[model samples]
Target: MSFLDKAKDFIDKHDEQVDQALEKVGAEVDKRTGHKYTTHIDKGVDEAQKRTGEGDTRP
Candidate 1:
């Protein structure tokens, strides 16, 4: 499998941890760039995922 595919599989098997890790990553990016767009995009994706009940799929 490609690296991204393996990473996605690893994430699906450990979703909560992966979600938290994603949050932390977005936060760190926000910190480094002094831009909130990434955070906003992340939040929008989360909201869309919740609405669609497609937890692991992209929004």
Candidate 2:
């Protein structure tokens, strides 16, 4: 399988963990950027989680 396919398989098998990790990564990016891109980061994280089959955790 190609790298993208392997990554997709891994994400599907560990969706919950992937979701949590994405949240953490987004939060870190927001912090590092001094919250200047909080909205963008959150949207990106939500989209990533959705694509990984975790659904949208955002309210």
Candidate 3:
């Protein structure tokens, strides 16, 4: 099993929690930067989710 495969499996099983973690991390980064790099941070998070095959389709 490759790392990507393992990650995909984990994502499939823990979708909600993973989403929450991503949101929290994004929020923390925004907070630390005093919301200066909000757009960049959001883009990074979206890219991360896309790379993980999760997409940005969640509500």
Candidate 4:
């Protein structure tokens, strides 16, 4: 299978973990950047979660 297909399958199986990891990474980036890029990081995280078919846990 192509890399994209394999990635999709992996993400489908680990969506929850992926979401958590994304959140952690986003938070780290926000902290390291002094929250200057928090808005952009959040937007990217949201887009990534959507693309990965991961459910949004944000209220």
- Give the runs in model 2 whose Cα sits over 4 Å from its true position: 57-59
| Regions of candidate 3 where Cα sits further than 4 Å from its true position | 1-7
Clash tally, candidates in order: 0, 0, 0, 0
lDDT of 1 by residue, 1-59 (tens): 99988866776676666555566776677777777587585785476444332264433
lDDT of 3 by residue, 1-59 (tens): 99989988998777667777887899999999999999999998877766553555458
Rate residue 8 of model 1 by lDDT: 67
The C-alpha lDDT values of all candidates are 0.62, 0.86, 0.79, 0.86
lDDT, residue 53, model 4: 55
- Kindly state the number of residue pairs that clash in model 2: 0
TM-score of 3: 0.70
Candidate 2 local Cα displacement, residue 1, angstroms: 3.1
lDDT of 2 by residue, 1-59 (tens): 99999988888888888888899999999999999999999889988889885565544
Worst 10 residues of 2 by lDDT: 50-59
Q: For candidate 4, write residues 1-59 as lDDT tens digits.
A: 99999988998888888888899999999999999998899999988887775566455
After TM-score superposition, what is the CA distance of residue 31 in candidate 3 from its true location, in Å?
A: 0.4
lDDT of 2 at 56: 56
TM-score of 1: 0.51
